[model samples]
Target chain A: MKKKLNLRKATPWLSAIGLFVLWELVVRIFNIPPYVLPTPSESIIVGWQFHEAIWMHAYHTLYTTLAGFAIAVVFGVVLGALVGSSRAIYDAANPLLVGFNSVPKVALVPVLVMWFGIGTVPAIITAFLISFFPIVVNVATGLATLEPELRDVLRSLGATRRDILIKVGFPRAMPYFFASLKVAITLAFVGSVISETVASNVGVGYLMLSASSKFNMPLVFAGLLVIAVMGIAMYEIFNVIERRSTKWANRGNPTN
Target chain B: MSNSFVELNDVKLRYSEGDDLALETTNMKIDKGEFIAVVGPSGCGKSSLLKLVSGLMPPSEGSVIVDGKEVAGPLKIVGMAFQNPTLLPWRTTLDNVLLPMEIVKPHRHRLRKYRAEYEERARKLLATVGLEGHEDKYPWELSGGMQQRASLCRSLIHEPELLMLDEPFGALDAFTREELWDILQNLWMIKPFTVILVTHDLREAAYLADTIYVMSKRPGKILVERENTLVRPRDQETTFTQPFTDLVHELRSHIRDVRES
Candidate 1:
């Protein structure tokens, strides 16, 4: 049993390494020019060689995503609570929210650039906008879909509406809230990078764009690797946080 | 003007105006600390009756009074359980049980200061329901029977004057259901809180209640009100007795009549 557990734990790392090795074999076998498609080894070697630049860009991207995500969390929860709790607010805002979410966030980058002028502000704002929707939608869904039986349990206690929301609704929404955080954090990275590529000079997105313009495919791949790693690191952090805080929600899933 | 603990007078309930009535005009008089079971066919609005009595829903036409006051909203002196148990999944068995103390006033205010005192009370209730050590486990971690037991503890923890149950044992298997019946009976025998238990199970009604109310199908109103004189502290053997069989048979026939009609 312990051996099986160890194998299960090792699968992700094994799969990742296997993919890199396959990429190397495919590149060598196909004799693909690095300018068109670089081997994983070349990407990693190039990435390490420019570690200082890559580290700076990665750090900036990480902090920007975190900042936007922080804002999104606060507003998303508040707006979600409002929209979820009352029929009137939901009816009034739902169409607008739906319309807003439907418009691809990438389309908004130019408008953000126009308003905020090509820099950190535009990147941060874009990150906030792109990531905000899921957090709000999930939080609202969590509160809105509270089982009627559960509501009756609280309502039957003579609990006020506020009391019900605070005591029951929010706690019930924790799993959904965390689920949104994971998605939103990843999207926040996308948002930040989109803004960086279009409007800013700093961050991994900008570095990749710079490398690509110079036809430095290996360097571009290196920057891509940096962004992917950051996204995965953030995702893992939220995953751990979720597993610790909402174990009850994961019932019937194999123990993580 | 009667001094019944819970009285529903000419009560009618509709989800909306000009809609089909969920409950027709129904009247009931329950004495303080009396245990009553409501039994009927499916869709008989037995649950609607409990909701009215507990003030979770108001009757459309007539006044419903409890403890000398007309119920304008949900009553504080009521503890409720449903077929689903409805224990918060996020909460530990004990925390779920103490949910009322976090809401019902005086207790909510004093919860921080007297949390330990309240915990002891909650612990005793859990112990009474055979959930003493399982208190710290999350509700989802427990079996269906154990979760339901914790729900029962939660309902009674606040020592409400009226305990409203809507098929509280309906989801359990037969053996677990029977075990819970005995546990519930023992607890009631000790404290004797007024109970309004709604169930489709005639044997359960006969075993646990002083009075059994049978209701008709939708737009439900009481069809029969039978008083039980069964021996006290009813057990498994009592269920096999001739009188018990007779009572269940009688209730079954009434239910069959309603279902047929």
Candidate 2:
């Protein structure tokens, strides 16, 4: 059991290093030229060579991603709370939200670019658009699942609807909000990259697009790795927060 | 009696139009600071009685009066606890106990200004229920019995005039249930309030209540009302006494008859 745990802990690093080795070997044995697919070493070396420009692009991506996520958080929670509280609003809004989510967010990037011009704003809007759905859904579920007994007890004490929402509804949704943040943050990255590739010129997605156009496959691969690392970093941050704020739910009675 | 604190006069109830009557025409008079228990077979409208008296539901046919006014909606003076221990999972035991104060009228207004006073009252109640040091712990972190203790505190903290309980100890183990009975009786002895506890346990009704009312099956009406002669501060020892056993037996026989018919 201890050996298994040790291996489990090592799996992520091992998988990462093994993937690099496999890519390097595949390139060497197949004698593939750098224009088509560069080895892991070549990608790293090229990525390091243009570190300053890559760094600038990465910074731009992070800034736009965070700005979009912040806006999504505010709008998603408010909309979710509104939808979750009343049966009428939930009924009216459910189908509309599901329909909007079904349409691939990438399809909207071109329209956004047309309306807002080719730049950071469109990318940020795309990130905001793709990420808010999960937040709304999770937050809604949190409020919807409140126990009937809890509602009855509060109402018996003359608690108004607003009092119930502030005291119980919002606080109970904290863990769910954080869970959605982790999911929404990663999706926000996907949105930003998609929009940047289609419209913007300053982000890592734009840099990768230019690199691909010029047959600089190594630099494009470097941009992909940077996004992966950033996504993992953001996920880890939210995971820690979710565990901290909602530890009570997990610590429930063992017999239960 | 003219001095009745809660008086139900020929009350009849149906959940909605065309539905079967949930409770039949019934009348009851409860004096101030009295403790009563309503026991019946499952689906016997015991809970419906609680709702009607607490003003959570209005009767279709008769007038229900409490504190000299007809109850139109939920009264501000009632505090309730349920079968399930519904302590807010996000809040600590102390905070959960302090919750009703943040909702009930006069207390709600004063709570923000006299935070320490309310906390002191909550702490005292929690300690009485043997939850002294456990106040900082969250509801889910505590055992079932502890959570119920916290729930009891939540109901009483507002100092409500009418306390309504719907099988509050129904989910607990036998040992925990008995332990809470003593704790609850202890709390009541110090400062009496009007209480209406609806339970399925015959012994619980026999042991805790000043009077016990038995109800028949659905579209229920009162079958019998037996005044408890069991004295105050009754403990586990009292449960084994001849009077207590006879009282439990009497209630059990009535419930068995109701269930069969």
Candidate 3:
């Protein structure tokens, strides 16, 4: 088991190192044009030169992503719990939720910008739109699929509805909630960047847009690298939280 | 008999708006501190009877009186365990057992002040079920039988006046099932709470119950009730004896009638 876990933990970093080495070797061997794909070293140099400026933009996108992600989690969980507990309510509202999900989240960016303007509000709203559905859908499924016998057991013990919700329903939904968080975190960053690209004066998305227009491929590559790093960092943080919250997975049984 | 602890008079139950009744005019009176087993065919309303007794549902056409009061809703003194043993995965075995104390009223009001006492009680209960060393372990860490044992401890931790077991050992292997039977027998022998066990296992019914009630299918009704003259603290050795097999075979023949009819 220890060996299995070590392999699982080591594989990602090993693959990443291998990919970087291959990229560097290919670039040096073929003398590929930097415009097509900047060599890893060239991109790193560019990334380091404007590190402070890149961080300022990175922080803006990060803040917006966080604010939107937090709002979506809170609202989605509460709403999901309500919808999940009642089949009638779920059937009534499912079409509306699905329809909202179908409409391109980017299309909402203009309307959000028009309403909230070109500040953090519009960007945060965009992130919320993109990240909210997964949480709501996953949590609703988790809440709905609780075993009937389990509910009967609680009922026989005279557990109140609130008691079941807090003690059984919410904790039962944690695995689903964490799975959704993995998807939501990446989408949140993407949504923030997209919003910034369309309607912002600051953020990594704006930096990428400006660099591309000026044909500064190296700077564009730098912005892309920063976005990648941020997404990975956020994913790692959430993965840690998921591991701690769900050590029950270690025993390979989810009886509850 | 007149001072029955639980009484159900002509109880009729149905599942849906227009379906036939699940239980039909079933009458029963249980004395306080008596242990009863209910056995029946598949799709019979044995479970429905338990539901009525626990006040999870009201009988369609009868009155259920527990301790001389009409059961308007769920009673706080009822504790239940089932075959699958659903303990919350997030909590330790000890926490899961103490869950009722966290919610049930008098205990709920005093839980914070009485945390240490509750823990001790939970520990003692787990120890009774042979789960003492596993207090800190989560439900997933334990095997199926171990988890069920922990679930039993959880059900009894609140010291409820009535204990309900809904096929609690149905999922276990024969050896484990018999082991739990002895454990359960010892627990009841010590406390003497009123017990209502719903099961398909005739031997289990014969081994554990003071009285066994048989029910018919669909719109289920009690067909017969037999008093077991078996002595207390029955061991595995007793199950091999003539009286035990005779009692089990009798219950089995009644279930055959229930199935065919």
Cα lDDT tens digits for candidate 2, B49-163: 9888877788999999999889998888888888888888778899999999989888888999999999998999899999999999987779998899899999999888899
Native-interface RMSD of candidate 2: 1.2
DockQ for each model? 0.72, 0.65, 0.52
Which one is best on TM-score? 1
lDDT of 3 by residue, B1-261 (tens): 379999999898888778888889999999999999999886888888888998988988889999989999887788899888988888999999988887777898899998999999899888888887999998878999999999898888888889989999999999999999999999998878999999998999999999999988887888999999998789989999999999888888888887887
Q: For candidate 2, what is the DockQ-based docking class?
A: medium
The residue pairs found clashing in candidate 1 are none
Error of 3 at B153 (Å): 1.7
Which residue pairs collide, candidate 3? B22-B219, B22-B220
Calculate model 3's interface RMSD in Å. 1.7
Mind listing the fnat for each candidate? 0.83, 0.85, 0.59
Q: Give the Cα error of residue B196 in candidate 3, in Å.
A: 0.9
C-alpha lDDT of residue A107 in model 3: 90
lDDT of 3 by residue, A1-256 (tens): 7797788789999998898889989988998888877788788898789889899999998999999999899988987998888899899989999999999888988999889889788899999889999999989998998888777767766788888888888888988999899899899998899999999999999989988898777889889888998899999898878878877754554321
**Cα RMSD for candidates in order:** 1.9, 2.9, 3.1
| TM-score leaderboard ranking | 1, 2, 3
lDDT of 2 by residue, A1-256 (tens): 7798788889989999999999899999999998888998988999999999999999999999999999999999999999989889999999999999999998999899889999899999999999999999999988988887788788888888899889999888887888899999999999999999999889999999999999899999999999999999999999877888877765643321
Q: lDDT scores for all predictions?
A: 0.90, 0.91, 0.88
Error of 2 at A156 (Å): 1.3
Lowest-scoring 10 consecutive residues by lDDT in candidate 1 chain B?
B50-59
